[model samples]
Target: VSPKGARAASAGMFITLAAHVAAMAPGTNIGAAHPVSVGIAKMDKVMGDKVVNDMAAYARSLALERGRNADWAERAVRQSVSIHAAEAHRLKVVDLLAEDLPELLQKVHNLPVKLNKQTVILKTQGVPVHIMEEGLRTRILKHIADPNIAFILMLIGLAGLYFELAHPGVVLPGVVGALSLLLAFYAFQTLPVNFVGLLLIILAFVFFILEIYVTSYGLLTLGGVISLLMGSLMLYRTGDPGMAVAWSVLIPAVLIITLFFVGIGVLILHSQMRRSMSGVSGLIGERGEAYTDLNPEGKVFVHGEYWQAVSEEPVAKGEQVEVLKVEGLKIFVRKAS
Candidate 1:
């Protein structure tokens, strides 16, 4: 019988230990399933101890019900041990073996089963099997378990936020950033995330921002690139195969991010160095008509607006003049002679 909790709950220990006369398929196995927590704090240790103790007690109770060796069951729980089909049969943990589901069902038919102080009879002979598929949430979590998808979410989240910050008031960037962040969080929920590595990634972003303001001759940019690469490499460290981000994904992602930040930084610097394209600076060297005679100061028409102007040379009314400088609301001009 499969237990309520597969590996991470005390209930599983009790259920798995409850079979007085157990049988298994040819290649099946039974074991204790414990939670994996790395880099956890003192609270984690305390919780783990509590779970282990609870599981051991449950296993002992099941052993008592089955009239088997309770001490051995308790020991197994305490040690987080597992036994395969052959070993389990040798130790009297399982009573019989079958080659297929039909055979197993035939073996289980009319067997007396004890569950939570209730004695029941299982009628499994010739019964139709029903299989339930995973729900949407479970399916989504399974997809997020993939390292490539998780890494992609992280990259998109960072890029969207960067774009939103660089160009404020753009609603699209903010919306995309929020969506990407939500997806990243969903991915993180399933994957083992290292907070220190996350902190390093955040620090890299800070360096990239600082590079924009502080002229560090690419020093801050280089540091940011290194930090980002290291942080991505160390983001997840579970022993699960294919759970960690691939080097192929990491190298390309780092290159893209570095190029993005450097390109943005250069663009920002260029924008800073560029002259104003509006107001007085925009009018310099622009041709306008002298509305009145230019005796050092007169009214000139430019860009559909009349302005008080001063000229370097003598000019007649309606003569075209080029703007040389702007003093407050006034324009200084030279005749287009």
Candidate 2:
């Protein structure tokens, strides 16, 4: 053991101490509970002192309750004390120091245990201890707690919904989006998420929509990209590395999502730039024949139909012409070259 002891979470320490109280035996050992050993930093002076004092009291109570060494427990918190199992047995913290659980159980057979309001005796000469595999739900929950998986699920949900919006009436996208979102929300509930970060991500989507409606010269899209990047960076604020969304996942996701918006924007712009493909406006470049003479006003045959016509130049009857433009049942024409 290092002279510098290890840290532990205070709440977990207290709970384990209670478990120690229930399972007290001459062979069992109760070690120190020092948060510093596990890398918990000392907080603000006021909060720090209170935390230490409270932890000390809880450990002290558990020690005394089990008739172990309370003084050593307090020293573990206040002075960062630690002791080996043999040393703990000498200090009345443990008894029957066998290396294996079976050996320990054999030695502690017929020993008395104090339950909340009952006394129990151990009897294990031939009894077997069964170990069960984790259930399906437990496995699922474990995977869902992973930040990378959660982040991926959220991206899938957002993409699915965007595709659904772009190509409406597609049942598959909506169904996939709804399922992915439900799973993502479940994962988020278990993760340490910052709501402000989440809101920024949603705001990014709003900016993306504005890029379609408001012509801000791509300013809105730039803002959306910045917001998305910031949000991805701030998604999980916990200091634990395992709880954080990995840079590998964050960087690629941000890039891909930005590309998604950019692609959508380009498609929208292309659609707007295209010439009209339906209705009377679709006849802008059709060749036709003058049905009657026009002193710049006459009828013309176009697209296999005769219709009202006007021209910038005069046309003799039956002269060939080309449509200059279509204006609400009127075809403006010019003499075909």
Candidate-wise lDDT, in order: 0.74, 0.72
lDDT of 1 by residue, 88-188 (tens): 66776656766665777888799887777898998987789997999999898787757677777777787788878888988797788778778877777
Regions of model 2 farther than 4 Å from truth: 1-130, 162-168, 239-241, 289-298, 314-320
Candidate 2, residues 263-324: lDDT per residue as tens digits?
88898899998987777777888788999998889899888898899988899998899988
Worst 10 residues of 2 by lDDT: 1-10
lDDT of 1 at 319: 93
The collision pairs in model 1 are none
TM-score top scorer: 2
Best candidate, lDDT? 1
RMSD of each: 5.8, 7.2
- TM-scores, all models, native as reference: 0.63, 0.65
lDDT of 2: 0.72
Query: How many backbone overlaps does candidate 1 show?
Result: 0
